[model samples]
Target: MHCQPDYKHEVYIWLKSNQMCLLCDEATHSAATLCNTCEIDLPWLTDGCEVCALPLPISGLVCGQCQRSPPAFRQVVAPWTYGFPLDSLISRFKHQGRWPLGQMLASLLRQCLQDRFDNAELARPDRLLPVPMAAKRLRQRGYNQAAMLARWLSRDLDLPLDEHLLLRPHDTVAQQQLDAKQRQRNLLKAFALAPGAQVQGQHLALVDDVLTTGATAHSMARLLMQAGARQVDVYCLARTPKPGT
Candidate 1:
């Protein structure tokens, strides 16, 4: 028999509260799907560049890349480095259509961001903007993971979201398949702002599932900045460590 949406939601919540840890298979004993021990053990990005969030030898130091040429965004905020189970989980969520995994990660990211907001470590954005996907790619994926993340974040954070403000009108090479330079080249002139969108003096956050090279974030942030956005920041679940680190 089919269940109503509300009933399904209630069931989902019930399962969540009684869930096993996604990694360790222990009873979570909490609303979170991850047990505290396993959660703490996840590849947390403890010390990183103040601007780009690249894992660093010490806290509060800028990576040389960012020092020489800062990104268009003010900062990148992520909870973990792209490693181990997070890499596996993100791959499954993005390519295999396991949205629950994405939802779980997004929930954790929300908690992390909330703590930062409480501590004044990072200022919240005026709106959440999911990096747009090309139409062909969106059709193949069925749902844009970035958009899903943004929607979940918007609801939980009580932040406004503008899905239509950014547009990826043309398809580019899959970013994961390219080197940083190639990825940058692939995205050249690949993104566009929606006509009549008002970004002037606004602080924006670009939401995505993972940040590998920062190529896409840079491209999108540049687009928004050129349109007079006051500030742009990236919010993602994971940040890849520096290449070969």
Candidate 2:
């Protein structure tokens, strides 16, 4: 009797979880690690600004901010709102080096992007460009999160990735802590085109892990257009909710 420690259920649960829902650590039959239940419950963006993808109360309409001064990009597409679990997961993925979390987010983005294509919400871009990171940041982080996401998207969408075209000349102060004006000024001349990299008339989509305040995306889009890109569209994992939303 002392030899039987009742470990049967624990072993069964562990085996089931390995083959099942990664979110709740429960048994399931889904091929994806994240079960349908968890996916459905994620803070999926329902309505957002047409131009910037900022979470909004209405759909199919541009927000006041975009109207006042439109973004350089033609459109922005983000699947989820940056809140709760997504925020925590992104934090772990970006800062804590949790690759699986990034992979899960990228897989979900692929599915969401398909739905967008089916609904004709977005058109396939000619090329994908991950937001450039400074050399120092890249070395410090060991990987650029945007580039990783873009690589995943390239495989999923069969789109070519052109990271060589864009270059960050220097590391600017983090944009999160700055106001809109300061963020814009901080990024001035921070990005530059690689010598002889052609972008004329190319419809490019810039990819990143998150869109906060739209400052960085706008800056990048502007740079692309200045280099003769016909259009730039933004793709991100999540869009931070409008302040106080």
Q: Tell me the alpha-carbon RMSD of every candidate.
A: 3.4, 8.5
Superposed by TM-score, candidate 2 places the C-alpha of residue 51 at a distance from the truth, in angstroms, of 0.5
Candidate 1 lDDT over residue span 105-145, tens digit each: 99999999999998998898999999998888887767788
Identify the candidate with maximal TM-score. 1
Q: List the residue pairs that clash in candidate 1.
A: none
Per-model TM-score, in order, reads 0.93, 0.90
- Lowest-lDDT window of 10 residues in candidate 1? 1-10
What TM-score quantifies how close candidate 2 is to the native fold? 0.90
Clash counts per candidate, in order, are 0, 0
**Which lDDT value does model 1 have at 38?**
80
User: 1-245 in candidate 2: lDDT tens per residue?
Assistant: 12112333543454445466656877666446677788888899999999898888878889999999998999988999998778888988798776667777988898888788789967888999999888877777777888878887898888899977889999989888898899989989898889998899999999999998888888889988988999999999999987776
By TM-score, how accurate is candidate 1?
0.93
lDDT values, one for every candidate: 0.88, 0.84
**Top candidate when judged by lDDT against the true structure:** 1
